[model samples]
Target: MTRFSFNQATANRWPIPDLVAGCVAAGVTRVGLWREQVADFGLEKTAALVKDAGLEVTSLCRGGFFQTPTWYEENSRAIAEAHTLGAPVLVLVSGGLPPGSRDVDAARRHVGEAIGRLVPATVEAGVQLAIEPLHPMFASDRCVVSTLGQALDLAAPYPAEAVGVVVDTYHVWWDDTVWAQIGRAGRERRIACFQAADWITPLPEGVLLGRGLPGAGCVELRRFREAVDAAGYTGPVEVEVFHADLWARPGAEILADTIAAYEAHVA
Candidate 1:
């Protein structure tokens, strides 16, 4: 329980104040925040609220969309936000290929370059840019770095403190090579964040929101936890599910279920 952090996306409709209060009431000391929610709530206000409640902002999601023309400016703002919120890591969702461009290799190379450009600012702000590789299904439009290995490769050039990779279960569970990559991430000290979300069956048409709570799906949740622990990742385990049905529930209920699931399947 000490290591568990509830990501805001898991309860998307929860108001910031209510979320913080509920977490405090439930003895949850950590949270992962999203940029959209923070912007809506007002960054300074959110920062103060969390600080007053004595809660830690585990990581800010996110800072990358390298395919966009405003990538540099937008990511710079994200780094600032993370710093203000006292979040040590800024999760990067490297955007996909440009329109009508199918060259995945080039798109990936661009992501690395973009990160290189942002490293200085991140280091200056005391924030780590954590590259998150989405599942390959999102390759065409969301993220081209579809494997943990690829994310690590992109973070290789920069110092590990400036750039690192995210190890999300839903994104990497299908890859047989992920175990080895997880080990490598530990050895190289490149794991900046670790997220857990199960891969549910009959993926909804909007696959982006098709994730399950820790025990609600077939993923070997305990195994992933043990792997990260064995790999020397002594960080918060953030539950970041994005299911429509889950989001529709009352915030407290969703949080209770999330904690129960994490305890039963992930702890």
Candidate 2:
């Protein structure tokens, strides 16, 4: 099997300690974590749990959300948490437009600026700020950054080690320009994290928990993996699924199924 890192959101209800043990049992040495959950579990405790279990926190769940008034402070804490957890990358999910504002361009610009502001902290913490572009379906409510190209554009001004983009199959799979953008990300030395999740339909209420495991939906998982490989991304491939059904299962079972899907599809 390829080196797979299970994103904790796949089994959102799993306690951090249990998730660490589950990864060890599953032979998964890496994981992607969410900030909220990390805080809930106590950052230092979660860090120690993973370290003791010999697991690597591949990337922290998120550091962005430029629209919030407290974004700077929150992201600063996220950077510190990522460092404590030994995660080299901090995923940034640019929040949606300001309340009721339709000027998406302005929001995108603000996200870029916010990221630039965070570069100093990320660089000092030895963490790469990996910007994740959500699907267009979430443009107004989730993230304004909806394309890999746009994500890369935002990261253009920062050093690759300080700011890069996440090449997640779930978000960019529907874009015909994705392959090209992956190549562009590589050329610019800006590809930080590669996340895999299949694009499923029958959207959930918020359209955030409908992602399927690698092989469970219609996305071209192997194609995306191959493209990322071709683009010079020699990094851990993280399986990050967010589905109500998946989360309802036991954590171990969910992780096992996630591994099966990654092997059959992404690996």
Candidate 3:
């Protein structure tokens, strides 16, 4: 419970102010925020609201999507947003292959180069860029980086303090090599963020919003938690679920259920 951090995406429809108040009421001191939500609520206002409520922004999601033509300018803004929000890390979901291009290798190489370009800005802002590898299902349109090992490889060239990898259980649990990768990330001091979500069956049509809350599916949530702990990652365990059905519920109800689920399955 002490290490649990509620990721804002778990309740996508929750208003920022209400989310902050609800988290305060629930005694949740940490939170992971998304850029879209923050922008809609006004960045400076959102920042002040959270700070005034005594809440710590764990990490801003996200800064990558190197495939976009304006990636440099966009990511520059993201870094500045993270700095204003007082978040120590900025999550990067490296975008998929460019349109009509089947060369995944090229896309990946481009992602590495893109991160290299942003390394200076990240270092100057005192923020770590955390590379998040999505599930393979999203390899084409969302994120090409589908394994923790690959994310770490991309971060290898940059200083661990400036760039690192995200260990999201929902994305890496199926990889047989992930356990060793997690160890490698720890040894190299590159595990920048840890996210928890369950893998549910019969993934919905879109699939992107098909994640299950902790204890809601087949993932070994506690095992992953223990692995990261063993790897010397003494940071917040952020629960980041993305299900449409879950989003339909009231924000307070969602937060309560998430906390309950985290306690039973993740904590």
Residue 265 shift from truth in candidate 1, angstroms: 0.4
lDDT of the candidates, in the order given:
0.95, 0.90, 0.95
Candidate 2 lDDT over 1-267, as tens digits, reads 546889999999999888988888888898999988988999888888888888878899888889999999999998998999999999998999999799999999999999989999989999999999998988887799999999999999889889999999988988989988999999998889999998886777757788888777899999988988898988999998888888889999999998988888988
**Residue-level lDDT for 46 in candidate 3:** 97
Instruction: Return the TM-score for each candidate structure.
Output: 0.99, 0.97, 0.99
At residue 247, candidate 1 shows an lDDT of 91
| Residue pairs that clash (backbone atoms under 3 angstroms), model 3 | none
Q: Is candidate 2 or candidate 3 better by TM-score?
A: 3
Ten-residue region with minimum lDDT total, candidate 1: 213-222
40-104: candidate 3 lDDT, tens digit per residue: 99999999999999999999999899999999999999999999999999999999989999999
Model 1: residue 91 alpha-carbon error in angstroms: 0.4
